[model samples]
Target chain A: MRKILLSIAVFGLMSVSAAAQADPGDFIEPIMPPQSINLGMVDLGKKLYFDPRLSKSGFISCNSCHNLSMGGTDNLPTSIGDKWNQGPINAPTVLNSSLNLAQFWDGRAADLKAQAGGPIANPGEMGFTHTLAIGVLESIPAYVREFKQVFGKDKIDIDQVTLAIAEFEKTLVTPNSRFDEYLLGKKDALSADEMAGYQLFEESGCVACHNGAAIGGNSFQKMGVVEPYKTKSSADGRVAVTGKDADRFNFKVPTLRNVEMTYPYFHDGAANTLPEAVDTMARVQLGKKFTREENTKIVAFLKTLTGDQPNFTLPILPPSSDTTPRPTPFSK
Target chain B: MRKILLSIAVFGLMSVSAAAQADPGDFIEPIMPPQSINLGMVDLGKKLYFDPRLSKSGFISCNSCHNLSMGGTDNLPTSIGDKWNQGPINAPTVLNSSLNLAQFWDGRAADLKAQAGGPIANPGEMGFTHTLAIGVLESIPAYVREFKQVFGKDKIDIDQVTLAIAEFEKTLVTPNSRFDEYLLGKKDALSADEMAGYQLFEESGCVACHNGAAIGGNSFQKMGVVEPYKTKSSADGRVAVTGKDADRFNFKVPTLRNVEMTYPYFHDGAANTLPEAVDTMARVQLGKKFTREENTKIVAFLKTLTGDQPNFTLPILPPSSDTTPRPTPFSK
Candidate 1:
């Protein structure tokens, strides 16, 4: 009887160890830096990203809205576009966006490549046509040479441009956050309050929608599940893409990786502070309100999501040739 | 008689060599890179230079008009400023601006430090007061820490801000141009046509006002020394500073270093191409006309002034805190 009991106890211990391997935080995963990337494509893409010549005004670049310096966001309520036109929705943070299942708030574009082309031609954004943008690149001999080398194509096209930009975007993942370390089996990474906040976050069912490697980007959730969110913004989220009333106010869950830096949260950017955003999510998404102390602790836990940012040299753009088209920023 | 002839020949050769030492092209001096800069102040200034938060709109930065990527100048006819406001005068290149005797086309500000503060308060430019700009920096703990480290000051002010920016600008000097190599004793650096162009430039007295290490930033010259220059631009130039009739239309001669990149020349930015600018300067400034071939040669010679641009990694700015004053980009 003693020998039989020892065998059963050993088997149970083995089963517990196996379960621990798969249940490392169960709902959360640590972000890892990209291992392999084409340096030539990334270099070309970086130049294109910072090149304001892509815009009709020659003033705005990809960095204008998704500024890498300031947590991959413009930090505005909404982005200011070409000719100072105000955008309808808040510009999403570009940091760790590669982990997202789909790009943009509405998940309209399939991936970063498809999403890259949207803003360049958007009437309210860059306000430039693909043909005009290509013409600008074609006029510059240096850009032509680089495109030929990177894409191995004689003809420069929008496909190649977006491809290069997407490749560069893939490298923008932020890793080594305190929360990520904790998930990776470092128990001492988080403070007592932060650990308590994590427990509350998991128990409150916030993990249902906000889960996976990005902590939120894997799913589409309704903005106001329990209560209708009131805002001045007219954006109908996924309804514009799905052509269905059921998808109204449904938006892609934003990644919480750099949530501390990406403030004025949500589709309309109604919540100016993390506390306000946290309180709103609790009341509206989960229909559960926590005390001020709990809210403060949760915010403290969120602050641990701030990670190392992408570091790169500012690219020096080639000069425009005599034949290059001039930007008519003032002309209609 | 043979001994005296030999002595005379030796004396002539020695005099010619001594003259050549003084004259190394006689008028223009090669620009040398700045040595021994404060790296801490420069790093801080680089962030300030690129930070759009300095502007009320949070859209325009010092880089917006004086773009380092595109030859330290926007290459625009005139600058598009806050709220897309059109600037009256052409924005000058910040490259090698430290070598200039004074700052601005009208020499309104004594140096770069003084010039740095002008655009921030200009109603049509950055459109932010010094106090408000200071508030933006003071509110961010990272900037505050950096300021304290660099300046050893508990309280930050506009003076230190401008000083830091000026220090960064001082390091923007572009050295090692082909022409600079020629000046530095590499005689074969210039082609035959380029040499001819240089000779023509000197013979035409174009070097009279444009003589210095910066090639043109040594003195103030009238825009049209020989004839009235026609322009729709209402900028009265140095008259704004001197408040004298003689100073009307008298502007600072801009540095010709990297002139190939800094295009759309003159205060009004009416001359679109280098050839056009050359022809206009010859006609109005020097009372002479050059043939198309000569103009092309001069343009080729001018291209040799293109130098090694400033290379540096893009700075990662710190996130704004909850108490930090938010940018009012859209609010009037």
Candidate 2:
């Protein structure tokens, strides 16, 4: 319990640090990252991600929730899945998942691979146990051979599925956000308002937990620093994972890669709009409310985080079933 | 009705004529048919085709079968599904699907777009319905915005989905096959055995129907033109769609593009190894027996049809759903 208190106190200092930066006008506009991209596995991963028929329901796909058009989410406060059952929390955008060291609000998953394997088995999600999932792939002689080629024979199991996906996600780095450009030394990357917002973000101290490559995700913090968050028992946040008193209200700091589009923020999805989220974060986490100008600037800065959507081809499904209705889309 | 019948007759004639082009010394290869590839549509369609999340089940992704890695197919006699249901037919490679005017052996879909929309709703395959399928994307704000941006506002419908996928499919072409090179004055492109096989293919009268840029997709014919197809109840073939007495034994001529890899051939998926499939097609379709030398040469030439796979990336699922158990190898 004492250690938990210390952890909370450390988190508080981190938030305060963001506001105390020397410039007090620190903004993170992602520019094209300096590194060359490793696209080999990523290319394979993208194809796999969009191709359905991988799920047992033949209908429950990854794009069912983290849709590219809808700010990376399906816009539901909580995601629904195979059974149309509710996911525990809001489905998060995949925009910058790579930047997060420990994933999920409770920091339960260590990386993207760990996260990729979760939903396919969850009762409300893809809903297949690993055994069932492997059986599905194994039964397909095509997959059996392909697995041998890509991951080596017997390597086509769940680990390769997760690893391949994780390797692919690493390529999905949103390198050149306008904010990133500015952060990487581009003076004209941001407009005046966005620059001002960046300043305010630093001055207001949001940079504390929401910094690093993803602008957040580096740490965890209590939802309500100024006021004890009163949002009704709220999904239990981190307590469900840790089962400790001080861990309550702590959630993973999400990447701000595409924050402008991934709205309805917070673990409970309480904020439906970006400005509202910023305002709430300012008031609750910062222990200080910002004027409209500051909030406006920060929101403007956030807009630059959205990245380019790559063009991809959808693979046509194979025809092999014995009988299918005209409307039955699964058969060839 | 008359036009349809006339066209069908002409198509049949085309198939027969191709079979009669059997010159003992000529190399039989797919002639590069000329047509303008809509570069724009190809760009869009390629993106859609690679996207697997369009289906209800994320796991039964298109690449799971018609993959570039394993000769454009998963090499299975049948495919697996969301609930681990083993599909009845082998997955076809998408390597050159653009050539086929009619899709699937049953010819259920008229175009690639129609084919694109078919699999997502197949109960035994993708198992997603139109409503749920659309809802899946509509829920994703990012996809919604993209549909609006790429196709147009509020155009996140199935039409757009199919069109985009079709556009992508058109680009999945085989370029500069050795046969193509040989035809274009590069005589050295063919090895002595390949030349022998090519000569036999032409002499075997394989080119009359299988001629054109995407050889063989231009027409449909009875499966057992010379030797009766024994599997009358096989995988519904093309009779399921047209339901005509004359169409009972008929099916679309598949593109021989990369046919070496898209194995376990025939509508009923009776063949296992490529050698077996090729040899059987000779006996059943051509009414001729191939000597060991001839068959080996033919198989060798067929391997040249394989194309290189394209590069892509995978998306990272958000970590909020971290129930991901440590993945074991995906065992067959």
Indicate which candidate wins on DockQ: 1
lDDT of 1 by residue, B78-104 (tens): 998888889998999999999888999
TM-score of candidate 1 to 2 decimals: 0.91
Q: Assign candidate 1 its CAPRI class.
A: medium
Which number leads on lDDT?
A: 1
Interface RMS deviation of candidate 1 = 1.2
Error of 1 at B1 (Å): 48
Q: What value does the lDDT take at residue A249 in candidate 1? A: 88
Q: Write the per-residue lDDT of candidate 2 for residues A31-145, one digit (tens) a residue.
A: 3442554454555465456534455454455665776544566655566565445566877777667777676778788898898888877766776666666655566555556
- Cα lDDT tens digits for candidate 1, A1-332: 22212322332332323323435466678988887899999999999998988999888889899988878888889999988899999999988888888999999999999999999999799999899999999999999999999989899999999999999999999889999998888989999999877777666656566667788887667888877888899998888899999789889988888898888799887787898899999988777899999998888888888888888777888888889898888878
Which regions of candidate 1 fall more than 4 Å away from where they truly are?
A: A1-25, B1-22
C-alpha lDDT (0 to 100) for residue B224 of candidate 1: 87
Q: For model 1, state the Cα shift of residue A39 in Å.
A: 1.7
